[model samples]
Target: MKKIMVVLMVCLMVLNGCTKDNTQDYTKVSNQTYLLGTLVKVTVYGKDVSKEVFNGAFDIIKNIEATVSKNEDNSEVSQINKGQEISLSESTYKIIEKGLYYSQVSKGKFDITIAPLVNLWGIGTKNAKVPSHEEIQEAIKKINYKHITLDQKTNKIQIHQPIELDLGAIAKGYVADEVSAYLMEHNMGHAIINLGGNILTVGEKPDGSSWKIGIQNPFDARGTKLGVVTIGQKSVVTSGIYERYLEEGDKQYHHILDPFTGYPVENELASVSIISNLSIDGDGLSTVVFSMGLEEGFDFIEGLDEVDAIFVTKDKEVYLTSGADEIFMLTHEDFKKKQMKK
Candidate 1:
């Protein structure tokens, strides 16, 4: 009887240990917060995931907004634009440096000083308007990225003119990258950071499979996606005129403005989505590629390393880079995929 009792107890303990291990191996926790005028969500999957982990990541994002956002009254960007030379925090300095780099590399195709044009059109604003020709020309004069000066020695930034700095084009992506790094540092190996439309992943999906991200249909309303990109640990950032626009009479005006024309960008490509290692790179290049149009955009992306793009044209034609075809799967049967040869 004693021998039988000992064997039964051992079996009970083994079953309990297995159950605990299974539960711990696949725990997932997530949280959503509103910041930077959009919904930001952090989903973490690991044995040690917690609400605290998500909160820590959210804090990093909010900190970025407090420093980089022009909307914030005392933000570093706002202070500099107000004609006051202000010293920057580490985060602010890095972002300013990157914005300038993008401006230089894209040859003014993407400019942070294009804020004046953004305000004039105000596509997503309550005061949205179709500005007069003269009004637009005046805004164009102030939309020069070269006017932004950064003194690396003192970490101070200066807007030489009346132009403002709007990092809306790239701030969310940088924040996502920062949060993702934090999660990985703490051993939260598998995580997802969704900042508005910008998404970044720290590792493969919980099932050890490739992660899947959806590309929104430009013609459809929000939540309507045309395709999915099956990727692993990458940032997916999409930019489109369809994101924010205003309709007046029979004409439609989008938020994406041309710094030179001070008007919405006119192009055959409806939207461009970039997938890259860094979210900031993906976000910054999305605007640059969108401004370049379809053909030139392909040439631009092909010159880069480890960056792929999905270009959706105005006529609903989906164009993919050679690398994009391997991961992108069109979920909506209505759209056709065209992968161009190198």
Candidate 2:
């Protein structure tokens, strides 16, 4: 199995605040488990919080994993990849639907059907390798989003081609969103759902303030912060070349592959962070924008509504969208914030 190392791009800072005596008795309950290829942690602070809440949240993740995980032998995606028609679960159907939307948004640059290329490289497994030019070309030919056939009425999916579907890019965020919804439904408002660094804040801090999130320093070790972003009830997700890669001799290949060339994307960006109301959007857009490089990605983000981005270049310069400055604060001297030229 290929496991994604904890890409701690956005780390949770000290979540402390002073609450007014009249409304400040919220208790904190948190638990961590290994699920969906990474460490999943769910923390909730609210009156009457219980272990059952965490259990239910994690259970939802497990259920979703079984339905959408491409690595699982009998998952819906796996079945579809094998060209076996199957009735999909609601979660699987919606994730595939949204994945197709992102595919279109990136003009097929961030394709979920790039599973053929993903397996060809195997960057995160013991079989990790650099495939031959011919192999890469073959894999690229199989990566087309149009092969996926989703029957909304029957909740079934069919793929006539030999393409495989990998949901790694967006599944984590969708799981986080579902968990967040579950928390809110159970009256747990203030919570932090971190699925291996895909951070989703449920509500304001117990003290009625925004949560402080540290943006990871791409060139530094895990937990190192280049800056901090303060927000309330939003999803913050980051994608970078440092997240996963395979090193061979003096050369290293990152996990973000380009469907066109069937190789790791070559760009000036070290990382891209997307902040949005939905974790699913953040998850997909981070990868989509990262592949677009700094300039194009910045322009794309500016055109989108209710979305903000933080782009950190390999040269240690940071660029932010218009709305980003309101929530983000640069704290590292090594990383200087630069204004994107209009």
Candidate 3:
């Protein structure tokens, strides 16, 4: 009787272990709080994974915030702002270099050096207020990416003007890419990293399904869905006038600003979302497309290959590039009609 009881106990323990393993096989959700302003949620899907993958991914994002955030006293961006030439990590240097290139490519439409203007407007902060014309002009004078110089020999960065560097636009996407890479390295079969609205998918769901992302409708405040895009192993980023804004006395001001004018960009579109292989590219393109009005934005999308875009105009018109039309599903009746007509 004792021998029989031992066998049964061993069998029960084995079955319990198998069940636990199966539960972990489908999805493992982990979240880390860092980045100074946002929460990073990482969902890994695989079997027999350790906590190390999550820790490593979280560390990458934390390191990025340490390196890039102007709010951090020890950050490289802070050093540059204080007129100190400081050496940067390779990842930090790459992101800034890409930011500078995009700033030039977009003709200053998307700029990291517009931090002064951002602070003056204070749309996303507690002190949100409208700045005077003179204040805006002074802010604009300090807002030029060209003044930021990079030393190739020492990999050091310097800012000629008294300007702050804000990576609010692209840092999340870059961190998403880094986290995705970390997951891939750890043989994480499938994963989704949603840094606020900046989403990156690696492989597919555990059941071999594509990742579905919902684009928020700019007109709706209660998270109404504008459309849905299904993608695998790609990054989806959206830049909108709705995400962060301030309203006062029948006037509304958004966070995205025109670097030259130091005011909110006056564009026909309410929001622009980009889907691309590289999360950083998607981040940069979303801002660029939003700054470009409808006509120029459509032209830019048509010129690109492998990059898809969806634009929601202020008039509630939805525009999809040839590539985007394949994966996006319209949820609203008006947009459904428009999609049928196309």
Candidate 4:
């Protein structure tokens, strides 16, 4: 799972900083809770709003988590992982369907069937360790997205192999989008949905300006910002090696595992942030681009429409896609923004 620890706080600080003059009469309703194995903060700015709106939004998140989370023993995913061919909710079915699409898009680099490799290393859990080469190779053999069988008509799923499925990379984004839509349906025009590192803005800020989102400095403390992105009604999601890892002596292993090698992906990138109309796209693309490394990832993102990316190298340099230059601003002098080759 991509757990963004400090970026959420930085975004809250940015939103709170806007009301210094007290001239904004827009009502701000905010609440925080622990969900999806991370902190989820939802805030809406509108006139005559009540906190009760959050209850519906949070319920949507809870329902998705219950349906898709592999950690939940009774989740539909878990049941399917256990060799049971089962019916899925329309939402869960769509999430898995999209996960498979990303798997194909990244050429299996960003696979939901990577749970076997993830469990073997257990980077974020106490069981984390460097598995034997033979063990890793065995796990790799089971990490094929092609083994998944989905029936579109009945919303049923079956696994043809002994593979575990983990939707940690993309589930939260789906939840964020669902909540955003729910809030909008209730007539809230402006809001910030921060599901750990996945950020989706409902509209602009209450004052008719873009919502300023702090991009986490992968090498620094969590709340420390390397830059801020000004966006309206878009989602910002980042995947990085610094957040979750396992260390052995002088060697450190990050949570992002390469399915082919059954090891952490080695690259020039420390993190990749994607901005898009839907949080799920940002979520999946962030991981996909990170795995592609800097140059190829930059070119790939540049070729895509409605998607822009920020590639931060381990050396502390920043590279932005064509459209990113308009909204992303460097806030730290320590990080140098580089110009991408045309």
Tens-place lDDT per residue, model 4, 22-140, is 24677777888999877888887777777688888889999999999888999998997888889999889988988899999899989998888888887767787889999999988
**TM-score of every model versus the real structure:** 0.90, 0.94, 0.88, 0.94
- Which prediction has the highest lDDT against the true structure? 2
- Report the number of clashing residue pairs per model: 0, 0, 0, 0
lDDT of each: 0.78, 0.85, 0.74, 0.83
Selected candidate, larger lDDT, 1 vs 2? 2
In model 3, how large is the Cα lDDT of residue 306?
Answer: 93
lDDT of 2: 0.85
Report model 4's TM-score to 2 decimal places.
Answer: 0.94
- Candidate 1: give the clashing pairs: none
Ranking by TM-score: 2, 4, 1, 3
Give the TM-score (vs. native) of candidate 3: 0.88
All candidates: CA RMSD in angstroms?
A: 12.6, 2.2, 11.6, 2.3
What does candidate 1's lDDT look like per residue over 94-137, in tens digits? Answer: 88789889888888988988777777776666787899999999
Model 2 TM-score relative to the real fold? 0.94
Off by over 4 Å in 1: 1-24, 339-342
